[model samples]
Target chain A: MSDVKKFMYVNRKAPYGTIYALESLEVVLISAAFDQDVSLAFVDDGVYQIMKGTKTDGIGMKNFSPVYNALGDYDITKLYVEQESLDERGLTLDDLMDIKYEDEDDDWAEKPSIKVVSRKEMADVMDQQDVLMSF
Target chain B: MKLSVLVNEGPYQHQASDSALLFTKAALEKGHEIFRVFFYHDGVNNGTRFTVPPQDDRNLQESWTALQAEHELDLVVCIAAAQRRGILDENEAERQGKDGNNIAPGFRISGLGQLVEAGIESDRLVVFGD
Candidate 1:
């Protein structure tokens, strides 16, 4: 196998309604397990995945926001939110879990070195990756 | 670098397609080559030729068609998903004995091999799915 060192995972779906969120999370965990440098970004409705205190029991689904916290155990700690997405949804940093907030900055301001970026910056970040997988 | 982009959401249904388009445009602008763009699940709707969004609104299908024409982008719709959703090309419509094909030009009917090929050949395979 080639020594692929970096990976970026972009999540673009809501949490409960479909399999995209869950499967994307699984893929991130698996990529991190292989010791690849993994980072995740949430765009559009995907921002819901990291919202604080999500309760899914009323909808007959298991609460899964806790998985966000568990991501730290796998060393896949670079979690990003598109600034435009947050602004469009009227969400602030306090409304989210413990994740680095970045807006077009390639360098992040949190643990695990995951940078949050804007839609415009995605191409540059993507270009720097050895492996990029979106879910 | 080789690249594969997975588009899972339908055009105009959400921002996923827009973001995917922007990403593809940016990737190309930066001199990166896209190996393939795979449409899975509801994304196959992107290949529909019958789409006619209200004249007042933006026509995403036209935008995608323009992109394909401009770059000769490899647009592939998953056969399984397209079949389930009734989006068929001429070959597929004939093979399945359907009356007609509704898929748009510049879009081809293909399988997971295109996706696998992207994963294997590209330096990175990014997905834009919902």
Candidate 2:
């Protein structure tokens, strides 16, 4: 059916500086409610959004980094983090927040949602999406 | 082919609206059907009827209105974003007790579901933003 479209959300900006990150999350949440096949890619500065120790208290903003932890509740578990972006920023996978979900089909085994991919590999994922929304 | 276009930025301040317009016009010229054009975030500002740009420059709102007139394009402004940005329709203005409504012709305020529906109904969903 044309209604079950594969949606890919591309996030290329850092969070907090602008509203793109928050607005994008809102769209993703809305897309999830539609039960569409959705995937998210964090490229460039977008990777910074998921990094650990993201304190927004000084900015008088809520710490939104923890929201990534709740994405699995919406069945949104495909989060691709570009490896090149992390390397350029001198960040390692450990620097990111651990986002995992329990797979009920697999005896409730915990599974990590974030996938580290190369720039080229991320391009392949983008190609497979029927609808791509950027933020 | 049925296409869905999403504009994520305001007009003039960014190249998004201009590019979206060009792309929509080209797609229409090529005989492609537009399922809908969703305006989200700051993009909702593009649906205001009260913009008064200089006479020398082309008015983006008028351009969009003319295109919608010619093509019957479905222009949907996200209600949440429109309300936040003060781009209210008559119903919304009355509900909010505002002085007036400023929603441009050919644009209707709706929910975020319209954006998702466009992706499902359209063959391609193109996003224009900064």
Candidate 3:
């Protein structure tokens, strides 16, 4: 019931090997703290951000992917995955974590009460939000 | 309307900076006011004056400098991030006993408050990152 606006975070980089994912996550958390309606879309290498079972200890980096699961507690549950990106990377819904999915065919269908989706569908959803931030 | 832009990736490392520049220009062209640009993490490198790209390249640092000059944009680099990366202004370089300053003009070293203020002041906050 908060009057806060809506925001869409477009993530396009891999979770690790760079600071983009970490910084983007921080921004999302901060935006959520303001009571904004927050959503996230993963495209390109960014899909790796929500992949299951990651271990970064060998690289002296902590595995932060687990923190993503806690986003729902902040009311940031809208997570999407680009269909083409998944197909190109040979990934399936099973390869990702538990979230909603938005396929191209479901554009006009009721948003599945879930969190996965395709890039084209994500663009449409982004247009509905007050702000679209890409990372 | 006022817009706050967040640039989180270094210039040329990805298309983030270019995209941000384009967005800023487009927003201005539409008669919008830019509240501020908060450069964080690796994005602080965009303000480094010592960077020189190859002769055949488009000098991104110079491009940013030009944008700042032309638009009088508020370019803010995070103090913590810049210090960790060895980018310092005249006062910071002198305080840290560095040989000279590496950060260019028109960019100020600031804290996270600038980002918060920008968010509060702008009607829209657009982030361009890696």
Candidate 4:
């Protein structure tokens, strides 16, 4: 009913081990329909949610990793990854899936959505959000 | 302040449900408006009418039901997550052709959009999860 509110979905748990990661994505996808200013913050083991080559065949779980690719189409693009979390996990930006969004304002130019930020920067992002949904 | 709460864990297995209930009660006592309380993931279990805890232990479902009645709260369980975990309401039971539905009083099965709407409408959205 009101103007758009800044929503940040803070993810901290590992994917698959718990249902948090997938369920958080479900809420993220649904939030797109509300025309809110939404962004995602991946810290701790949550960084694993976007890792490339996620194989769940032996585990017999639905590999929902591919669903992250469809996020760009939902008009939800900002994904802030904490640099410290990646370093502690021995992961690099290259380890993540290449999620891109087509910028409508720039003649539909493709741009990478995942922005690697320092812990301090991530804190600032969280500080500015009107609503924070943690998982 | 207007607030919305999201619960992401089951009743007895985790403390999230209890914490959320206490937090909601505290907020209500302080004269704050609770826009909605959205249940997701294993949190949908809190809406089951058949949960029978020990006599000494708190009946979380009934507690939540009573709270909702007192405050006129909007207690919503995510429909997709509920269906996956077998938490069907009357309409859902008939739609899915299930034999029974176990949704407790004062809680309704709805869409994930309700969660988003809660986030947008509330002054603060407090999440109770792992």
Query: Residues A43-84, candidate 1, lDDT per residue (tens digit)?
Result: 888888888877777899777777777776676667767878
Model 3 C-alpha lDDT per residue in residues A59-134, reported as the tens digit of each score: 9987888678777566666787788888899998788866433334656343332355666787788788876766
Candidate 2 lDDT tens digits, A1-135: 435778888999999999889888888888888989988999999998898888777899877787789888888999999999999999999999999977888998989999999999999999998888886
Worst 10 residues of 2 chain B by lDDT: B121-130
Using all chains and alpha carbons, the TM-scores for the candidates as numbered come to: 0.53, 0.94, 0.70, 0.97
**How much is B29 displaced in model 1, in angstroms?**
1.8
Q: Which ten residues in a row have the lowest lDDT in candidate 2 chain A?
A: A1-10
Report the alpha-carbon TM-score of model 1 versus the true structure: 0.53
Ranking by TM-score: 4, 2, 3, 1
Q: Which 10 residues in a row give candidate 1 chain A its minimum summed lDDT? A: A100-109
- lDDT scores in order: 0.75, 0.91, 0.78, 0.94
- lDDT string for model 4 (B1-130, tens) is 9999999998999999999999999999999999999999999999999999999999999999999999899999999999999999999999999999999999999999999998888888898976
**Range of the 10 consecutive residues with the lowest summed lDDT in candidate 4 chain A:** A1-10
- Candidate 3 per-residue lDDT over residues B1-130, each given as its tens digit: 9899998888888888888888988888898899898898888999898988899988777877787888899999988778978889999999899999989878889876576557656788987774
lDDT of 1 by residue, B3-116 (tens): 668888898877778888889888988888988888876788989999988989877777778888999999998787789789999988999999999999889988655654
Identify the runs in model 2 with alpha carbons over 4 angstroms from their true place. A1-3
Question: Comparing 1 and 3 by DockQ, which wins?
Answer: 3
Give stretches of model 1 more than 4 Å off: A1-135
Q: How big is the positional error of residue B112 in model 1, measured in Å on the Cα after superposition?
A: 0.7
- How close to the true structure is residue A14 of candidate 3, measured as C-alpha lDDT? 91
